[model samples]
Target chain A: MLAAARDAFAERGFEGASIRGIATAAGVDPALVHHYFGTKDQLFLAAVQAPADPEELLPEVLAGGPEELGRNLLGMFLRVWDGPARAGGLALVRSAVGSEWTAKLLREFLVARVLRRVVGTLGYSPAERDARGALVGSQLIGLVMTRYVLKLEPIASASRESLVEAYAPTLQRYLTGDVVLPG
Target chain B: MLAAARDAFAERGFEGASIRGIATAAGVDPALVHHYFGTKDQLFLAAVQAPADPEELLPEVLAGGPEELGRNLLGMFLRVWDGPARAGGLALVRSAVGSEWTAKLLREFLVARVLRRVVGTLGYSPAERDARGALVGSQLIGLVMTRYVLKLEPIASASRESLVEAYAPTLQRYLTGDVVLPG
Candidate 1:
């Protein structure tokens, strides 16, 4: 049923997809879908199949506050990749790379589920929060591309611990420092 | 001849393509291929295509150094997008999204031509340089996704000038600053 929903979502973007369509594709009655998952968004989330809620992960990560947030995020992401959650990580990246629906799904997961809540916790203004979020998003997305998607040489082969060490401080600054603006 | 070469390169990638094959596909003499392009690299460059060369544009952009580089790069990119050169950009993005050969071409262009040469001018180390380059690449690629491919609201509705104001500083930071690393 979830696989059917994923195919439907991938073929027809979020806006184009319908609950009825998913129900039909999954070989279940519409009421069955309603009983199993309450809303289209919930069904879509199930379809994408992420291992864990980034929202649940973010607070525990930021519990350390801004100081070690970068390190924590990197460490957590590495753990997800190294563990049983590897398929989930791959799905996120593949979806992000695969089609517009996947990209939209990934974007929503990043913003609504992760960035907004975390930035709210930090008590930043909208602009500051978004700027910082984009910075962090750029780094995380780039790392995934380099390490997993592109599979470039030494960086691709490097230990996850080494990458965390190399990248954490940069995330720390984006999170907390007054880095100079480019004129 | 050029069309066949472009298709072959797009399908097979840089290393996988051969001058002899391109010549045979084009129904041209192999000697003619050698005569025109001199080497496979030269032919490959012609096949892959691009907007303006960063080499020619970068000096003009950096003429005012760190202060105006953001504006300069943004302006340069928009001009390329707005001009007849957009075909190369579109072709490259479409290819990168699905085709491995095309992705290799793009990765090479980013790392070797654009990133290495342009970012290297800033005098950072190899790792630092690649990281910064990757960030800049993602931003530009993301911009393309929103503006041209996905046609997202606000971003598509945005004026080129407004986009420059909103994005140039971030681009400038990726080009020149200590970027935030992911947790």
Candidate 2:
């Protein structure tokens, strides 16, 4: 079922792929797909094996409050990429670079599941929040590229806590600083 | 010869691929390859179609002085990636994500060809310089991923100068600030 969903999502983006079509491809009822996966969004999370559950992340990350948002967020990013989800995370990132379909899925997942949920609670206009989110995304994605994918030395071996400390301020500024948003 | 070199590089990393091997694959003498390409570094740059020429970059980037390093560097990067080199640069980055061989070639090219030359003039110990280079790399690669590969909006459509203004400080800090070295 998950494989079918993956195929469907891969062929069509999050917007184009339909729940009923994915269900039909999976040889299951639409209702069953819902029962098993909850929604298209949930199905995607399962399909990509995304470990980013806003529910799990919100409280712990927000626990640090906005002041420590960058620190907590970078630590969590390191944990996810460095921990058990590393392989899946790597695969998804790898595929996303090569495939527009995968890139779209990743963008949708990031904006919908991760960025919006986390930053929505903060008091910024939607446009401002998105600008901030994209800025934050640029830094974090670069961290993953250097540390995990490219495996650049010193960075690849740098301790996680050290990375969090080094990078947190950058992310913090993007998330909370008075950035010059693009008009 | 270029095709042969690209194939050899695609199969073997920068260090692993030999001039002899590439020449043999091209059915040409190694001396002939050297005559045409000048050096292995030059050969790889032509093969990868890299737009980053340190000789061209160093004087321009340094003119901004160390304090303006981040702004100048980001501006240069944006110009390189956004100009006529966009297609080749995109291809190289996308391939690197999928192939370790490509990734290694990229790393060698980036470090030996680009990073080392630009940063070598700076006043820092080998370890400290490396740490700075890697941090700067993280942010720059992330900028590429978001603005180009991911096509994440606001960032995707954001003006080049706006991006430079926003990200310069982060790069400046990584390059010139008193970052806690990863000892």
- Best-matching candidate per TM-score: 2
Local distance difference test, candidate 2 = 0.83
User: Which segments of candidate 1 are over 4 A away from where they belong?
Assistant: A1-34, A38-44, A81-98, A125-135, A165-183, B1-31, B34-42, B49-52, B65-71, B78-91, B122-183
Which fraction of the native contacts appears in each prediction? 0.02, 0.67
Candidate 1, pairs of clashing residues: A70-B183, A73-B183, A74-B183, A170-B181, A171-B181
Candidate 1 residue B177 Cα shift, in angstroms, is 5.6
Question: Relative to the unseen true structure, what is the C-alpha lDDT of residue B57 in candidate 2, on a scale of 0 to 100?
Answer: 71
lDDT of 1 by residue, A73-167 (tens): 88887666667876677666555655666766665556555566665567777767756665566556656655655544445566777668766
Give the clashing pairs for model 2.
none
DockQ of each: 0.14, 0.67
DockQ-based class of model 1: incorrect
| C-alpha lDDT (0 to 100) for residue A24 of candidate 1 | 91
